[model samples]
Target: MDLQQMRYVVAVAETASFTRAAERCHVVQSALSHQVARLEKELGARLFERTSRRVRLTAAGEAFLPAARQALEAAERARAEVAAASGEIRGRLTVGSIPTVTAVDLPAVLRDYRGRYPQVRISLRAGSSERLVDMVRDGTLDAAFLGVPPGFRIQGVHDRELAHGQHVAVVAPDHPLAAEHEVDLRHLAEEAFVDFADGSAARAQSDQAFAAAGLRREVAFEVSGVELMARMVRHGLGVALLPATFAAELHGLRCVPITNGPVRVERLVWSRFTPSPAASAFLALLGVGAPPTAE
Candidate 1:
C-alpha cells in the first residue's frame, strides 16, 4: 500500500526473518512486523507463514512479492531521478559489456564520461552477451554493449551496429595454421579447436558459420573469454574462432582470417526504451543512439 510497507515485505521475503529484515531496514522487529501486518490486512491475504525454525512466504505472498519489490524499486528510482534532475548527473550507473568490447572499445568512452560527469558513479560488468542481455532486461544494468546474435528477438531493446568486425581463426605463432593467410571453416574441421562456451555471442556466430558451411568443429577446450581463448591458443591449447580485432590485439596470438563464404558481422547493441540518463550520454558519445550528422 505504501513504499515503507512494500520495502518491509520485500526485506522479509529476502531475509525470511522479521528480526533480520528489520535489522537490515534499520527498524525494530516490532515495527517491521506491524508494517507487514498492516500491509497484509490491507491486501486481505497473509504475506508470511511463521514457523519456529523459519519464515516462509504464503502463496499470496509469493504472488505479491515481485510486484511489491518492483513498486518499491520504482519509487526509489523516481526519487533518484528527481535528485538527478537538479542539474547534477549523480547516481550509480551500471553498464554491462562482453569481454572483447570491455577490453578493446569501452576504455576511451568510459574515460571521457568520467571526465565529463565525475560525480556519476560508473560500474562495469563484463560477461557473455547472453548474461548481459539478461542483466539489462532485469534492470541490473542501465544499459549494455551487446553483440547481436542471429535469430534472437530485439524488440524491447533498440540496437544499431556500432562497429563491425569478423570472426577469424587464432593460433600460436609456431602453429601450423599460423602459416596460412586465411583459412576456411572446413580446414579447421579436422583440427582440435578451442571454442567459446555456449551462450557467448562469438560462439553463436561461429556456430551459424560452421552450420552454414556444413562442417562440425571439434571443440577441445570450451573457454568463456576471448582473452583466455587467445592465451590458450598462444600456448598451443587449440585454435579458436574469435573476433579478429580481439585476436590481433593479443601480442602472442596470430589471427588467421576465417573465410566462411559469408563474413560474420559484430554489432554493438543497446536498449531503446527508457535507458537511464548516464547510459544515454554514453550511447550518444558513441554515435550509435543519435541521429546522423551533416557531412
Candidate 2:
C-alpha cells in the first residue's frame, strides 16, 4: 500500500528472515512484521509462510517481490534525478575497497571529491574482494574496488577494470630465493610462504599458477592486507606473492618476478540499483557517470 510496506516485503524476500530484513531496513522486527501483515491484509493474500526453521514466500509474495523491488528503485531514481536537477549534492556516500588496494588512486580521488563537494560525507570500508562485492550487491556499499581476474563477470553490478598489474613474489632480502631475479613457480613449492586468505584476488592468481605447475607451497601465515603480508615477509615469517604495488614502498623486501604469473586486475564495481546523489557525484568525478545536460 505504501513504499515502506513494499520495502518491508522486498527486504523480507531478499533476506528470508523477518528479523534480518528488519535489521536491513533499520526497523524493529515487530514494526516490520506489522507492516507486512498489514500489507497482506490489504491485498487479501498471504505473503510468507512462516516456520520455525525458515521463512518461505507464498505464491503471492513471490509474484509481488519483483514489482516491489522495481517500485522502490524507481522511487529512488526519481528522488536522485530531482536532486541532480537542483545541482545540490549533499549526502553520505559509502564505498568499499580491498585492504591496501594500490590499484585505485583513492587518496587523490577523495581529495578531489572533498575539494569539490565538502558537504558530502564519505565512508570507506576495507575487506576482501568477495566480501566487498557482497556488500555492494546488498546495498551496503555504493561502490567498491575489487581485484578480479580478467574477463570475470558477476550479476547485479556494473564493473570495469580500474587498474591492472602483474603479481610478484617478495621475500626477505636474506632469503635463499632473494638472489634470483625471476623465480620459477616450482622453486616455491617447497618454500614457506605468507599468503592471503582464501578468495583473494592476488591469491587467485597464485592458485592458478601453482595448479598449472603442479606445485603447492606451504602457507606459513595468512594475512588480510597486502601491507601486512609485506611486513611478514620483511620479518622472514615467509615470502609472499602480491601485486607489484605492494613491493613499491617495501624497501627491505626482494621483488622477484614469477614466470607467466597471473595478472592482478583491480576493478571498480557498483550496484545497478539507483545511486544516491553523492554516489552520482562521485561516479561523475571518476568519469563513469553521464554528464549533466544544459536546460
Candidate 3:
C-alpha cells in the first residue's frame, strides 16, 4: 500500500527470510513483518506464503513485485536527477563477474568509477558465469561482466558485448604440443584433460567444441576454479581449453590458439527491471548512452 511496505515485501521475497530481509533493510524484523502484514490486509491479498524454512511470494505477490520494483526505480531516478543537478550521486551498486574475469579490467574500471562517484558504494561478487547471469536476472546484481560461451543467447536481460576471444589450449611449457602455434581440438581429444566442472560456461564451451569436432575427451581431473585449473596445467597434470586471456599470463604454461575452437566472449549484462543511476552511469562509461529495452 505504501512504498515502505512494498519495499518490505520485495526484500522478503528476495532474501526469502524475514529476518535476513530485515537486516538488509536495516529495520527490526517485527517492524518489517508488521508492515508487510498491514499492506497485505489493506490489499486483501496474501503477499507471501510463509514456512518454517522459507518465505516465498504468493501469486498476488509475484504479480505485484515487478510493479513495486518499477515504482522504486522511478522514485530513485527522480532522486538521482535531483542529485545530478547538484552534482552528487550515492547508492549501493552491486556488480557480478565470473571467475577469471577476462572481459574487463575490473580494477581499472572500479578505480575510475570510484574517482568519478566516490559516494557510490561498489559491491562486487564473483561466481560461475551462469550463476552470475541468474543473479543479474533476479535483481541481486545491477550489472555484470559475463564470459559466456560462444553462440550463447542473452535472454530476459539487456546486454552489450565488451570483448571476444577464441578458446586456446594450455599445457606445461615443456609439453610437446606447446611448440605448436595452433592445435586442432581433435588432437587433444585423447589427451588427459583438466576440465571445469559441468554447468559452468567454460565447461559447456569445451563440451560443445569437442562434440562439434566429433571427438571425445578424457577428463582426467575436474576443477571449478581458474587458479586451480592453471596450476594443474602448469604442473603437467593435464591439458586444458581456456580463454586466451586466462591462459596467456600464467607461469610455466604455454597457450596455443585452437585451429577451430569455441570462442569466449564477454558481455555486459543488466536486468530489464530498470537501471539504477549508478548502473546507467557505468554503462555510459562503456559507451552505452542509454539502457536498452527489456527483452
Candidate 4:
C-alpha cells in the first residue's frame, strides 16, 4: 500500500511489538496500529500473529518483509541520487572496520568526511575482517576496511590493498625474549601466546604462518580486542604477534621484529554494484577511483 503503512509494518515486524515499533517510529501506538490494520485489510492478509505475550510474523508477512525493505531502500536511494544531482550529498553511510586497523587513520578520515559533508549521517561498526567482508557483500555496510593474510584474495567484492606488513613478536618487559632484536617463528612458537579468537582472519594470519613453519604454539589467552591482547602480553600472561605499526602503540611492551613471521594485507572493500553517493564521496576522499559495477 502506501509508504507510511509499509514503514509501520516494517517497524512492527522488526521490533515484534506494536508499542515498541510505535516508539521507534516516533508515533502513537494507536495510529501505528490503525495504519498497519488498514494495510492488512487492503491486502486481504494478516501480516502478524499478535498474542498477549508476543508478536510473530505470519506466512504472508514473512514473504512481504524483504520486498518492503527493498522498496524503502530504493526510495532512499532515489532521494539521495536526486540530492547528489543538485550538488548536495545527503544519505546514511555505514562503514565497518577491524579493531586493529592501521592502514588508514580512520578517525581523521571520518572527521574530514564529516566536515566536508555534514548532511550525511555516518555510522561505524567494528568487526573481524571476515564478518566485515560478509557485511559489505550483503550491502549491510557501504564500505569496510579488512585485514587478511597476504595473498588472500577477497571474493565477490571490489577491493584495493591499502597496506602490507608483517607481524612482530610482542613480549612483556621482563619476558625472556623481550631483549631480542629479532626472532623467528620457530623461536616464538615455544612460548605461550595471546591471540585472537580461533578461525578469525586475524588468527588465521598467525595460524597459517605457524603451520607453514611446521610449528605449533599454544594460545593461552584468546581475546577479541587488540587492547585486551596487549594487556595480556603486558601482564606476562603470554606473548603476542601483532602488526608492527599496531604494536608500536602499546606501551610497557617489547616489539621484536620477526625474521619469518606472518604477513598481513590491509584492504578496503565495497560492493561490486554501483556505490551510494555517500560511499562514492568517502571513497573519493581516500583517493580511490570510481567503483566497479557487477559483471
Q: Against the unseen true structure, what C-alpha lDDT does each candidate score?
A: 0.74, 0.82, 0.84, 0.92
**What lDDT, from 0 to 1, does candidate 2 have?**
0.82
1-295, model 3: which lDDT tens digit per residue?
7789878888998999999999999999999999998999899999899989888999999999999998886686688767766878766688898866687788898899999999788999988878888898888898888887878888877888888888889999899999998888778786898988876787888888889888888999999788898888888899988888877877778888888887888888888865777877787777776665565
Q: Which stretches of candidate 4 lie over 4 Å from their true place?
A: none
- Residues 105-184, model 1: lDDT tens digits: 58888898899888778999987777777777667776777664556565445555555567778788999988899887
Q: Find the candidate with the highest lDDT and give its number.
A: 4
**Clash numbers, per candidate:** 1, 0, 0, 0
Model 2 residue 16 lDDT? 92
The per-residue C-alpha lDDT of model 3 at residue 213 equals: 82
Candidate 1 collision pairs: 158-272
Best by TM-score: 4
Compose the digit string of candidate 2's lDDT tens values, residues 137-185.
8887889998766655666777778788787888899998889989778
Task: Kindly report the root-mean-square deviation of model 4 from the true structure over all alpha carbons.
Answer: 2.0
Question: Please, what is the TM-score per model?
Answer: 0.72, 0.69, 0.72, 0.91
Of 2 and 4, the candidate ranking higher by lDDT: 4
Q: Comparing 1 and 4 by lDDT, which wins?
A: 4
